[model samples]
Target chain A: MKPLYVIKIGGNVIDNSENLYHFLKDFTALDGYKILVHGGGKIATQISEQLGIEAKLVDGRRITDIETLRVVTMVYAGLINKNIVAQLQRFGTNAIGLTGADGNFIKAVKRPVKTIDYGFVGDLNNSSVNANNISNLMEAGFTPVFCALTHDGDGQMLNTNADTIASALAVALAKHYDTTLIYCFEKKGVLKDINDEDSLIREINPLRYEELKKEHIIHSGMLPKLDNAFTAIACGVKAVVIGKSDELGKLGNNEPFGTRLSKSNIS
Target chain B: MKPLYVIKIGGNVIDNSENLYHFLKDFTALDGYKILVHGGGKIATQISEQLGIEAKLVDGRRITDIETLRVVTMVYAGLINKNIVAQLQRFGTNAIGLTGADGNFIKAVKRPVKTIDYGFVGDLNNSSVNANNISNLMEAGFTPVFCALTHDGDGQMLNTNADTIASALAVALAKHYDTTLIYCFEKKGVLKDINDEDSLIREINPLRYEELKKEHIIHSGMLPKLDNAFTAIACGVKAVVIGKSDELGKLGNNEPFGTRLSKSNIS
Candidate 1:
């Protein structure tokens, strides 16, 4: 079997029809192995506002009250998952839509409550993810499209950050299939300076990352992404790359399109 | 091997301080249950509003975007789950907060992509909840609080409805152990009319429920709850009930304080 390529996409791509369509087209053109994990946070907020409901965020994370969780489930899993599956099918990508709760593929633990107790958020450390389902889907010639929400051990669903979900998935698939994990986002790659688009960090090591974090050189969002990338590498993933969505196919061909994180810098 | 009780909580329970404190007081008293599935919609919306993000809903569901999903996950599974766990612990109920993605339980299938797809939402059709996790926690005198998010066959995490997650869990647990799924909400029972709060329907059969759905009598949010009730029944769940959350302890003692859904209408 060809080496599987695991890709993590953000929720921004959910409504960006042209970008999604283009990415799917490129994704389908080159075929070896693939899985897509995406996020859908913006769309949910739109709906919440219409309903006169307020959204809360703590430290860059949305607080999942009861109604928000339900709304997101309906959109992320039922609607978005199916929607992506349909789009992939349109381009003959042989796609299958899924959430993390199915077949126990992606697992999580509830995040410890903060000062103002939210409802049900989770920590990546508290969860476990299984990739067998992805293997099964790939064996059946189907590309699995995943949403970010998984089951904690206690017979309930918990919302997970998409970046963390992708990293965990990459670790699972890497150990299972000896594949590469690629995370695509709005930016082309990790940059040293937010303002300087050309200051992309081509390679990242743990020591430098920690120094950068402490010095406030890396942006807040990049902190978690880097952590997840480190985790994927530590968990025996072959490689981790932070790049743009449209150029993911180039990643599989060993193109240095983004910041690369390897085992030495992680575990 | 005592029968497991799977409780499904509503988001409204956490809206206000008084309500939250009261709910914690009551739920903590009934902490001997095997699992707890919680909801969190209001929190996500609050954050979205603050961030200048508009909330969107389709077919009565919230659409999740990357940003919002992250916030909610951190809130629901991270913050809220912990709060419930901590409250239960304060009442001498050894509790462990968890999300559905833990232990590869409660997985979901993502919706295929299409026009106006629901973002980050999940379908509960595909799930493999780890009943042993809940059972073990119970055996160890720990209450495992479950958040509403299940895994699909792939590595992605998708959002799940609390009721749906609870129902699917009950079904999954029933195959191994006698499981009772309880859905707690503000209403005393399933009402015949939305306006007539007193017109409570104590019970409903699948056929009758379907007729109500077909005739558009059951109405919006109630639709999925009803579907979950029937699914639980069909999947061998010992019992299902819809009622107020404050009566959990009474219900725990098998006092039957809620609107019970049984196979037979009345003995």
Candidate 2:
């Protein structure tokens, strides 16, 4: 199977134009099939505030109300997604911006009203992804750029987590291709010391992950992300990388760009 | 060649929820390949007002300043486009919403500033439409739902006229498909008398069009639309239909739903 990269970029890179530009340049320079999953940046929140829509929270978790969903759909799927696609096009990448609703590529269920209604938030199930259609699109020479939005398959757009979208896509496409899921955030991978970049863990296999967790080195904030990464690996994704967005070019140079997570250290 | 419907819906249909829902259902029910081109609705203006972005007009013509461009990009390409795509998907049409930037599908040149600086407005030239790529996408079984947005190849998204985009697409795709361009608006069709619905001109050939202009039956507001329609007809589009969006279902029944323009009435 051909190697395919499923890269997810968070709001940190998207909020800064210079970082986005440099990251896109590096992304375009990489050869092979790739898919981009982008998170909603601060623009959505800013727009929501401007529109006088208050952020609803349920026990500290953000709630995606109708207004917030609309704003996110506009910012994530519209403004940022198209801008990235246009920039990629400028660099000779035939990029097509997408939401899960497009082509029914990802059909998600509205988060069930348990304890509290999540409003328009969608949670993915095993059958949510149409991997065959995505592979067909990539084979037809169109690189998909997805925003952090999915649909309920009943005429409603739903806000979804971008990291979950990336992992979902990576796991689904793993059957068709040797997939590597990369999560690009503010940090330079998982670190032994959160304050120190040089303390990057480099590589964390299942054994190392358990050891780190038992040692209390892996904190609560990074647990979910690591768990998600390991889950993807178990589901057939060849590897998962966590790193900073600006250092994307290092992947091409075969340099240790970030923390690589796999079943074992021996690849 | 396969028959294809290239339909353009103006703001009137889009602004009303009932009208848009019914129009989408009708659109989905139509047999054969179809593409939807939508105009920016009042929502853009509403959002612009909320964002405090003033409409910059020069000599009665709206100038698309960078601010206005951003708002429209958010509304048209993001909100309206995705909503339409999601709704269409619910109706079982695998609709993919798009701007010209996606897949480098439509490349436009920024409008040249002569008497007016249109800011980020894009003008479609002869080579603007990527017919082959569009045809390939359609053949792949995905319906293209377009918003009035294009890119200037150099990483800029330009505000484009939906009518122009529809006609340009029709003219270009005519080579690959038997294309019929439909413009859906508030009126029933081009009327002999503006006040009377009974005065609907059911058919207009070039000779009849000249007579209508000579008799002053076709008013200033309708001239550009008709000129565009006739130009498209001359450029190999099989026909052009102007009518109310709600009456779309009438077409399936072989009933006169709108004023049909062709080279001659005999067709």
Go through the candidates in order and give each one's DockQ.
Answer: 0.03, 0.87
What would the TM-scores of all predictions be? 0.49, 0.97
- Candidate 2, which CAPRI tier? high
Residue B180 displacement (Å), model 2: 0.7
Candidate 2 runs further than 4 Å off: none
Number of residue pairs clashing in candidate 1, backbone atoms closer than 3 angstroms, sequence gap of 3 or more or interchain: 124
Best by TM-score: 2
Best by DockQ: 2
Compared with the true structure, what per-residue lDDT tens digits does model 2 show for residues B1-267? Answer: 999999999889999999999999999989999999999989999999989889999999999998888899899989999999999999999999999999888999999999999899999998999998888788777999999999999999999999999999999999999999999988999999989999998999999999999999997999988998999999999999999899999986678889999997852
Please name the candidate that would achieve the greatest lDDT relative to the true structure.
Answer: 2
